[model samples]
Target chain A: MPHDTAAHDTAARDTAARDTALPGAVAPGTAAGPAPVPAAADDGEQSLARLEAGLDALESAAVSDRRPWWRIVLSRLLPPAVALAAIVLVWDVLVWAHVRSGEIMLPGPGDVWNSLVAEWGPSRIGAAVWDSVYRAAIGFTASVLIGTVLGLLIARIAPLRAAVQPLLSGLQNLPSVAWVPIGIIWFGVSPATIYTVVLLGAVPSIAVGLIDGLDRVPPIYLRVGRNLGARGLDSVRFVLIPAALPGYVSGMKQGWAFAWRSLMAAELIAISPQLGPGVGQVMKFAQENLDLPLALGSIIIILIIGIGINQLFFAPLERRLLRTRGLSRS
Target chain B: MTLTIDEAAQARTLTETAVRLTGVTKRFGKQTGTPVLDGIDLAVAPGEFVCLLGASGCGKSTLLNLIAGLDPVSSGSIEVSGGRAALMFQESALFPWLTAAGNIELALRLRGVDKARRRTEAERLLRLVRLEGAAKKRAHELSGGMRQRVALARALAQQAAVLLMDEPFAALDAITRDVLHGELTALWQETGVTVLFVTHNVREAVRLGQRVVMLSSRPGRVAREWRVDIPQPRRIEDADVAELAREITDELHREITRHGRVGVDKGASGHAS
Candidate 1:
């Protein structure tokens, strides 16, 4: 402890000395004579002192700081696991007390679990899940392409932006299910109808996100970009897009949610036999048969998939982008 | 006519001038706006280091921007000798997305340097700023001084004969700013790039510039010029630099008082309250 105190004293003394000497320390030979050689020598000495200080900063930062890996993992995983356990406990108690209805009416956690594991096989439920996921993926990919183009156009062209920006916002507020009626009238109960609904749900969110992102790009960045000889497309590609990426990624995440919700709504309402029973369709079928456990099982699957895609893809992508800019915690 | 003769003379003088601004006037808008720079004419010679010293709102940065082609002169011409000059701002201005070396390489890339040579050239520039080891560090990770050093290196990579700096070291702490001054002086000697540095710090201007030009605000105009004959590698605290800075500070105060229309202190002398 004495040694530690002594070391701390020395470090404090060095800092105090550096603070006073930094600007006040005149070139060594200037006292005896106003010689340029001595002045240059003095600069060399000051530079060496600064370099040593910088190296010390870097070294200390590296040595004294480290977060344990296990602690980080525990912090990330513990909360969600506890939440799931609590939900299950509450469900079991409700069913045991016969809170609402019989097993046919409100299924217990065990009944739902049984229906998930015992009744639905990979042959039926797996394909249904895949069908829903595939539909969402295709629709989202198309929205990303088309919406990005639309957003960029809206951002750059003032007249078009004025014409379409309010409309885009209006479209985003309109429920995706509302689009199903129009879609059915236009395309019937086909894949195309599902796509139309998904696009209707997703495209405005993505496009509006992009337009907001582009607007939020700092004007200083654009000025520096142009000054560095980045002209026209080069400026947008290098300066504008990278600066706007955080907003863009969030927009994409929102768009994905919209696409998934719209696809589920479309599958439930349209009921296309050609397109294979999706997760939504399975839930609807279960409801028609009064199979509460199966319906609850399908709902759980949908929720899991939604959470999985975000945790696996969008969250990581957003974190990496923000971390590079030092906008997020490591 | 007289205009043609003036143009011929201007063309003749263009060879030696790294930057030439002839009667440059800048107004932000056509409606009820005072001109920022009013008929300003300045010519910087090749390889010379000049500091533009003025108070805040003096349009020093506006002038630098005009010279760098970032903004157009309202009714006059600005010739950079080269196509465009490189400019550095007080805020390090390095792209946060790029690492130290990546920032430098970007400038080189825009200047059409071959892809294979950009890395080595960027390394050399980083070495010149004594930041070679920080090549992989992002702008936020480095210290304030280090970020400015990288920005300087990026400006150097532009390969322009003229460099415009708008208070590029004003944000640093005293120690870091002093260290950067030394480094900048050394770099200027080694590279021989013509530097037009803008700052309000009188001691800094005396310590760094071969020629110091003072500007007055409220529609900025060049007020006075001084040739600094003090020897190179001058410290900010040096006796001669302090003396010159005191003189400039007095003149700057007078310039400020001239703009105060309401507080008409006719007999206050050098001490304006």
Candidate 2:
């Protein structure tokens, strides 16, 4: 009983001395007294090991360790919206101040808003955006799908990848607007013509993007995937597809821009009522009538649609992908 | 004591053996006089943790690649009792596009697990690796250890009874590497999967393996073997582990420093204490 009591008292004294001597609980006897210090350090070493184990437990990243769902949604939505609002407010102020001819060259926010409303009106562009949307969606969807298929066909098969690699690169650099003439010859003065223009313009972007993405995938991933018993289509779908999605998405974004521009260009050059009215056709009619607000309005609407799609759709998707990988933020 | 397992022994623990490489030889056959591995003979029993320790030119990776079925053996044959073996590399090599969970789920999908089951399996493996909450985390988002754990989960999702690890911890820092060693050791014990670990670090071999196999430096051969009898939860700095590593280090250094130079081992006594 005396021995136990003595050991307990010694431990209490040792712990108190340790607390007094060290910073944040390293044994005080370590630095103070040399004799019995090694003995003290044995305790310190054991404690240090416990501390290390605790740190491992504390710092380890858990798989379910995600922020709540709505928080993620808000975190993603807030930044882009703030930027968009800032831009809109600045434009409104500049136009209200007549900084760049609210009436002429840099039409004010109200003027742009008026154009937005007027265009979407029963007679004007309410119907027009739907046309552009349809054409844009169709063109973008088709190009994304077709270009991905083409890119995969080119990337995987050695002979095909080699043969079409240069062809794809060359196609990317060559402007799709240049293909308008060829498109006109093939599918002239109709919806087919506009769709053709969009196709020619957008397909290359998607295909080229997919190719680059595929090329960027590290060879180690393939080796590991193969070892994991994933092969052929299984490899491509699970490994290649997911691995290449970021690049593929970027390609889709670029292809969208091309398709939109191409459709507008086609509509402006060759107008037909059966072809459906779009921003381009509306802009053409407005310009002809000398209605500058309406013309400028149509242009603004197109820009807004593009901006909205990028900010609302693709930007969030990209952020989510990058953030999930812990690539974007620590 | 006995490496061989008899029929009754096999029946009692009837799990499939991990890997068997017989006369395994990998030869480029271009200008190099000999093949990478010459008549390599090796076998790993079920749930056995084996480490292949060799110097750089020994083609240890090539041997692993063959066992993994990533490359065909030039001469010998590799047999695994399970369906196939999954490989993990030095680089975590997690797919950048997918989240940590998504990456594991893809492995499940390829294994033809149902979509609903994949998420649960992925989550379960993540928990096994102590990365239970990092399901949505991406590759770069993780610290080195975290990424490795996620990758380990992904590798495990393949459901292969054999795991071929090619120096998977060579890139980590001392502290992170230590933690990972514990995690790996624990997981290996729990899973009962055979591990064929190839590494250059002698201490790492001592720390992780139940059996350590050393290959000769140039155009690798089975140089020596050590059966580790130390208890688990080992650290690299453990006196026994360090002592074994030192002995193997002498052999490894001798093989690495001299190419058949007759007994001029003057540097042995002069090494770090």
Candidate 3:
């Protein structure tokens, strides 16, 4: 786009040209004086254009050019980039040094790649991914629901808080994986055990997070809410919850971490063919077969899936909440 | 929010009282610590502006809190003809989560206004505070004066007959404070709701109050009374307001310098139980 001064300069040049040409009408052949005047007119117009451009430039922040579309795709692929490269290099180095074993023992990256492709078209690998996704989702949802209610209770009720504050903190310190044996005994290798594991993992983090969030809310907001006629649950819903969003989001992030880790641990310990071939079972199978590349590949896939879920859902949710609340830079 | 002014007036005339306090004493627990507000008797006639002035820790805020139904009065009865009193704090105390418009809307929501009327009512209150253009701005984005104005609008939206303010302009700069004082008095006169304002600034009391009640500290009690006969638009430096302020301030000094005097005054007023 041309600068705003360009038009202004043209108008100035027109006026200058008119001033010089008015006397030139008397003698057209004697064009030397007119020639000098036109050049001067051009100079004046150019200066005017420069001045106008400067003003426009000063008035606005420069608009930035968009990055290439390739960058968007590259960002999505970048997390797995180093792992992919390193694995390839390791496989090549092992084979070149004659350290690679047979297909079932210390399998090469190419062996795992072939296994993934062979399993892909049959829909089995897709089913496995979806199975894990669905189970984890159910567990996560249940934990969020139960954890939020318990957290709110602990935050609001004096007696409950007194009874539960220390217990909650203590429970949080105990790893959810430690409860796997009990969860298995209680609910067997079914989704029930999976959910129990997930809840145990996530609930404490969420509740603790919510408490932290609630604590940070200013006392003045409570006073204001009351003065505005916010009584009982209305105050909590409208005032307390929104005011503590940052804490809530952080709590959610922590809860997701617990849930993901717990699900992986649960599946690893309580694997059954009846329970479906999820990522944890795949990891176990690869390890038992002594296929190092396949084991590493399964591990890599799980990490990628976890990160993808976060980036696709929770991260965006958090970013938007922060942006709307002006907690994030615009 | 259901405390209707029309009903309050009809009830007051029928019942013959707007607010009545008898033997109200607020005692904080400790061996060395004294009662924040020892004993007090105060009565507010309808459409009156009473300024409560004292030093810090004189229980000015405690008094406001009690009247606003935020806390129970210890050892005394505070009766309001209005069901509940609306309160404004020194800090704007607006919810940062809500925009200026949204803050006003919360009050309206509590008042049982439906979704449709909330926007219009919020806009009306915003204009009343001379802030029609700032409705969409978040609470933190507003200037201190603007935030207080939004807070005032929210309080007004509560639709209570009594508006209790605890140093609502204390955090504001002088020019904004002066402007707000004028705006407040004008609004008070127009609304005709009883006002009980608490402040540590003596001249603010004289400038804004029709009757300034001087409070003693370390066991707050009514130390003295000054009837401010100054007309509207009075400045703090006005000879009349300053002269009255000096007189009251000297009494405040006496109250602070000495100990146990506040209790004696309370007992004499028959406000000590």
Candidate 4:
């Protein structure tokens, strides 16, 4: 039976090949027009493979090339370092030239550096930084969870989207610091007050970011997903989420900024013993004591933490996402 | 020579049809609106290559969408003997986040292909599309032709009995398009999957399809049909292919001119009033 089937298959293949070779021999509209056999013999297959490989190699050479790690690091670090040095030099020159008003004294860069190292111990500075970072982390994480769910709901449900879209945009535009007064009244100078302020500030922007991302996803991807047997949730998981990722990541970055700023504002205004000493509390203490160098040092620390977190975390993340998708040049 | 419309052929019943659409009509907005596809009755036999040719806005794509089950038909039924029809679009529509192999594997994974088997199966499909080395390349990294080939591989990974393609090669350069046409024909022959390819290009229809069906615009209906008797390895410049393409283009021109004159007459009367 095996031998007979093999012979029959060969005969069928030959007839198909003959039909292709001599097309007019078989009339059109014949449903039984023989199925064309795989015409690629071993030789033909090898040649085709060779041709395709050459084409791929030639074309892929134009694809984005990776710079060496050291080069990338140097490029990223050099310009910012130069700018910082230039600003410091200008500040030092002004102080040397005695450019000052009567009451407010602009501390020299060295004075600020000394305050950073000598006045506050390394452990104290670390603690202050840690406290603020911890609050920001918690607030941002909560905002991400809430924002993602809210965004997905609004994106999927038409009525919910229509109702909430305007309100969401309005909240995003409202300054998060404006919530500080309401939060203090509601929670009374506690961590709850700070967290409430942070949430209100960050959630709107994160949710809006996600909505915009979901909105920007091309209609074609959804059609392709449905056609490939992906039902409702499956479509969301496989197609919608990945396509919206770039936008979502950018949203998370903006949310972190808002969360950090809101936390600082709350800490400066609604301080309590239970809240502990964040960078904002330290800055407020320096202001009360009228210590110019300590105040300058605290401000610098705030700037460093903000820049450091974004540089260390979000920048790399956004870069990686864009690189993988070929959406970025470098 | 004027191509004959094989009316009997259109009505003929095939015992094993991959796709059967009977009186399929689709209207976009209101119930009273003229249908995008007016009573489209098409039956594609297993392993048959059918090209649906028409002018722009003739609803060739709408017909494919209806058959592929991406959109609902207003009045008629579509039955596919296969599990589901896989579709390919003009833009490739590949997920940018995924590599070529990942894209194909996603399709396989969706169809419930086992984890261990998916890798090998994806590799096999890539080879079938002559893209063995492009497994790791993302959609944007590959050339246009390569991306389309990857899209084709991903579609085939569905293991669908019928494949619906809507102007899949319309964006490529002429040389790339020609090369892809040969590859597509070869792939069709090897896989023996039923293809319902929609295109506005007449020569493309004659080059690839076993039968060409023309759709009339302004509520698209099957206006004419022609069986292409050209052999495999037929060129776009071949005498027989050109002859058939000229006849189809002439019919298409007439259809357009007729519509044009009616619009002009309406404008003239409206202006006078």
TM-score of candidate 1 versus the correct structure, residues matched by position: 0.87
Give one digit per residue, the lDDT tens place, for model 2 in B25-53. 88864536767888889888887899999
Q: Evaluate candidate 2 by giving its C-alpha RMSD to the native, one decimal.
A: 9.9
- Residue B262 lDDT in candidate 3: 48
- Tens digits of lDDT, candidate 2, A1-330: 233343345446544654575443243221211223243445433343343335444454353466888997798779978998898898778767767544456666677567667557676688888888898898888888888888878877899877777877787677666766776788777777777778888888888888888888878888877876678888887788877887888888888888887877777777777787888888899889877778778877788888788878887787776665565653
Off by over 4 Å in 3: A1-118, A156-163, A320-330, B1-17, B29-34, B259-273
Q: Of models 2 and 4, which has the larger TM-score? A: 4
lDDT of 3 at B57: 73
Taking all chains together, each candidate's TM-score versus the true structure is: 0.87, 0.77, 0.76, 0.88
What is the lDDT for A142 in model 4? 93
Cα error, residue A212 of model 4, in Å, equals 0.6
**Most accurate candidate by TM-score:** 4
> Please, what is the whole-model Cα lDDT of each candidate in the order they appear?
0.83, 0.77, 0.76, 0.83
List, for all models, the DockQ compared with the true complex.
0.27, 0.25, 0.12, 0.32
Question: In what order do the candidates fall by DockQ, top score first?
Answer: 4, 1, 2, 3
Candidate 1 CAPRI level: acceptable
lDDT per residue as tens, model 4, A39-104: 554433333434555555666676557799899889988999999999999999998888888876
Runs in model 4 deviating more than 4 A are A1-58, B1-15, B31-33, B265-273
Cα-based lDDT at residue A240, candidate 2: 80
Reference-based lDDT, residue A288, model 1: 97
Chain B TM-score for each model?
0.91, 0.89, 0.87, 0.91
Better of 3 and 4 by lDDT: 4
Q: How far out, in Å, is residue B168 in model 4?
A: 0.5
The CAPRI classification for model 2 reads as acceptable
